[model samples]
Structure formats: structure tokens, C-alpha cells
Target: MIRSIIKNQECFSIVQGLPEPGQDHNLVWLEVHTPTVEEGTILQQRFGIETAKKNSNVVEDGQFLYMRSRLLALDDNGAPHFGGVTFALGEQLVAIICDDANFQSFDIALQRLRRKPANGQSPKAIMRSLLQIANDRADELVDQIAEELEKRAEDISEISDGYNANGMELGVPDLIETMRALNAKEELIALCIETQLSLARTVRYLSSEIDSTNEADLQGLVNELAFDVAGVKEHAYFEHQKVQYLQKSVTNILNIKQNQIVKVFTIITAVFLPPTLVGTFYGMNFAVMPELSWEHGFVYSMGLTLSAAVLPLIYIKRKGWLR
Candidate 1:
């Protein structure tokens, strides 16, 4: 879908369809929402663009995606799932291509722009608003991630305390699953940071090339956007780091729990090994072995085997190995 925001004397005049040929080209913003290949072709022709921009990852007929004469750059757009925003600055117009029809960022940035009369619906202002919206959204996500991490951390503490108080046995399955979740969350935030980085780069790259009638005003907006997005990226990095710390802590706890279990089993085996040896020796003392044939030998062998087991337990207790 194509929409035209014609620059009125005071406010923007929003139209539903594409601008007609020889239409009001002076001070207009054209936004394309989820344009098809045919629409892209038409727009390319109308705007005098020789080629359209393609994502670097997109390849067809063994040809890698390269920069087009009109295309500036495309941001990373895989895990984001949401359509990526593409900016194409032409000689006579600035085109924004995106997939989502319900663009929350567009609405927010436009509202902010509307508040300042000095900043009407110019293409440069619209682009700035778009970037601002992205930064704001990213900031909100950071807060949400922080809150979630806090709650999860508390839950982990509770789980640890409970296990320690009960039987000194940690639930390996539950901890392992939670660890996996934290790892996935880390990956998601890292992707957001990457997207923000790409966005900031795109803005800075276009900072010099934006051919606006008002370059001085646009330059400041571009610089401000770069700064804001950088902050968002940093916060995202911090959140990811916290998640990593939590994951590592859980892993260490898991290792300690496993080691404790192994140590207990080792002590039990040690306490029983001597008794097992005694029993085997007495069983072999039959007719050929005089102890087994003698009347008192059976009682003697039983007492000796019991003593052997008790001696190991006493030694282990003295050494505090049983503890």
C-alpha cells in the first residue's frame, strides 16, 4: 500500500493512494507498506531508479545482493520477524519501505513531529521520527528484560534455598531448562542490539548524502538519532551480559550439586568394600580351608566380616568423610 503525505501550508494532507504523475512533488513524503515486486518495479521506474535495493542475504540466479544506485542500505531482518524499514533517498523524493501496516513507531514519531510546528511533515523529519520510534521501542524492551531477569533471579534463589534446606539435592532438570531459557533470551536481546547497531549505521551513512532543501536542520536530527540508538544498543548489551552471568552461576551450582552426589556414592562404596572382601574369603574356606569345616569357624567368620564393615564406618566417621 502506498500513501502520500502532501506538505500542506500548516499540516500534512494524508492521501490513501500513490501520487499521480506530475502530482504535487514539492515537499511530499511517500510511504510504501509491504510493496510487492510489481509495485517496486513501478516505483523504481517512476522515481528514475535504475535498480532496487535487495537484502545482502537475498540471492537469486547465483547473483549476490549488491547496493543499488538508489538503495542506501538494508538492516538485518531475520529473527526480528517484523519487516525491516528501508530508506531510499531519491533526487526528487524520499521513500520509506516497510512491511507492517500498523507501524507504532511511525505513529509515535509523527505525533512528536506534529507537536513542533517548526518541524512539519518534511521527509527529513519523518525519517528522524522513524528512528526515534525505534529507539523508544528498544528502550522499553530493555526495561522489560531487566524486570524479567530480576524475577527469574529471585525464583532461582528460592529454588536454591529450598533444595539446600530439604535434602541438599538440586533439581537438575528444572535448572537445566531454566538455563536453556536464559540462553535463548540472551540470543534475542543480542539480535535486538544488532538491529539497533545497523539502524544507527544507516542513519550515519545517510547523514552526508541526504539531499534535502534543509540540510542543516536534517544533519542535527541525524546526529541525534545516531546518539539515541547508540544508548539503546548499550542498554541491550548490558541486559545480555546480565543474562550470561545468571547462566554461568546456574551452571556452577549444577556442577557442585553433581559433585556432592558422586562424593556420597564414593564414601558408601568405600565403607562396604572391606566387608565384601571378608565375605568372599570366608566362603572360599571350605573342606580344603580348615576354618570353614570347623564348628566355631562359621561364627568366627561372621563376627570377623561384621567387624570389617564396622571398622571402615568408624574410620570414615573419625575422618568426617561421612559428613
Candidate 2:
């Protein structure tokens, strides 16, 4: 579907189809969502907006600035998904194309534009507004992921203390879930980093090509955006490292638990070994075996076997291994 928003005579209005080509207007924004074959052709023929290739960097084709953006959206389960958004910026027009259900970024930019008077709105201004909105959303999502990782880090630390925040003893399943969450967050952070880097590139190119004259206000806006994007990227990288550390912590905890189990079995075997040897010696049928014919032979063998079992327990306790 294709929708057009036109700023004419200091008023913003939505038009049904693309604004009449070459029609005088202060500025126009065309949003094409999941455009069909014919719609794509019309867009290209009328506005020279064509599909960008696999590249994510902004490029200038003498007539317009073309770039592709990765739009991030969360699903019902709060998982992040990326979609493609193609932007074509011209002298007085900005076209956004995406194969998604909605153009949320455009909607938000439009709402903000409407809140203020439409005085002196230019194509560069509109493009900046859209990019700022996208950058803000990305930052917000990154912040949320950071907060979750912090919480998860605390939870894992508690588990290492032998219990969780709820005072319940930690189990393998709990660690598994924590690992899963960390992995998911890691993937999201990686995606955020990629998106931020892409935006950074776009911002630089947009500033250089579109803001060549360096209008004071616009230059400041671009600089602020670049700064914001860089900060988000750095934060994302930091959280990514945290995720890695948490993963290792979980693995180490699991390994410790397994070692404890093996230690227990080893101690049990040591405690029973002497008794097993004693029982075998007593059961031998050789007539020359000492104490074989004594009246108290059974009693002696029982006492000796019980003593053998208790000795290992005492030794283990003395070494503090039983704790």
C-alpha cells in the first residue's frame, strides 16, 4: 500500500495516492508498505525511487540519496525481528518503502511534525525527524535489553550462592533458562549493534550529502544523532560482554555441581571398599585361614566390617570434604 503526506500552505494532509509529480508543495512524504509489482514500477517511473540492492550504506545517485534500513520490531513474545526499509530522499520529497505490515517510524514522525507548526519544514528536516525517531526507538529497546541483562546477572549470582532470589534452591533447569535468556539477549544486542552502525553510516552520509551547506540547526541535529548512535552502540557492546560472562558463569556452575556429584560417589566407594575386602577374606574356604574355626569368628568379622566402613567416614570428615 502507498500513502502520501503532503505539507502545503503551512498545513499537513494525507493524500490517497502519490502526490501529483512536479506539483508544488512545501514537502511530501511517500510511504510504501509491501508495494506490489505495479506500485514499484509507478514509484520508479514517477519519482525515480528504485529498489536498492543488498547494501545498507547510503549512496547518492546525483538525483537522490538512496539507503536501506533494518527496521526492528518485537513480536508478541517480545522477540526482536528485523525488516527492510528503503529510503529515497530528493530535493523536496522523502520516500520510505518497507515490506512490513506498518510504517511505525513514519507514523511517529508524522505525529511529531503535526504537534508543532509546519513552518519551514524541508525534505532534509523530514528525513532527520524520521531518523531521530528510529534512533530513539532503537535506544529505548537497547536500554530495555540492558536492564534485563542486569536483572539476569543478579539472578545468576544468587544461584551461585546456592539459592535464587525467591530463596528456592537453584537447579539445572534454572541455569538452563538463564542461559537461554542470555543467549537471546546476546542475539538482540548483536542486532542492535548492526542497526546502530548502519544508522551511523546513514547519518554521516546524510549530513555530508544533504547538509552540505551546514545549516546551524541541522548540523547540530546531525551531530547529536551521531553522538546518540555511538553511545547506543557502545552500550550494546558492553551488554554483549556481560551476556558472555553470564554464559560462562552458568557453565561453570553446572560444572561445579557435576564435580560435587562425582565427589560424593567417590567418597561412598571409598567408605565401602575396606568392608568389601574384609568380607571377601572372611568368606575364603581355605582351612588354614586364621580365626576360621573360632567361636567368635562371625562376631569378629561383623565388627571388623563395621569398623572399616566407619573409618572412611571419619577420615573424610577430618579432611572437611564431607561438608
Top candidate on TM-score is: 2
lDDT of 2 by residue, 57-78 (tens): 5667777788887766645554
lDDT (10s digit) by residue, model 1, range 1-323: 77776665666566776766766565456677777778778866776422344655222322111111111122233123334666655444556666565442454444565576455545555666666666776666667778888977865675565464445654777678779888878977777777777677666656756555657777777787888888888888989999999998788878876887898888889878988998787667366787757889988888888898899889889998766
**Over 4 Å off in model 2, which ranges?**
20-27, 52-56, 74-79, 117-120, 212-214, 287-293
How close is every model to the real structure, measured as TM-score?
0.75, 0.89
Runs with alpha carbons beyond 4 Å of true place in candidate 1: 20-23, 49-51, 54-83, 99-107, 115-118, 162-170, 209-218, 288-303, 320-323
TM-score, cand. 1 vs. native: 0.75
lDDT of 2: 0.78
Error of 1 at 98 (Å): 3.2
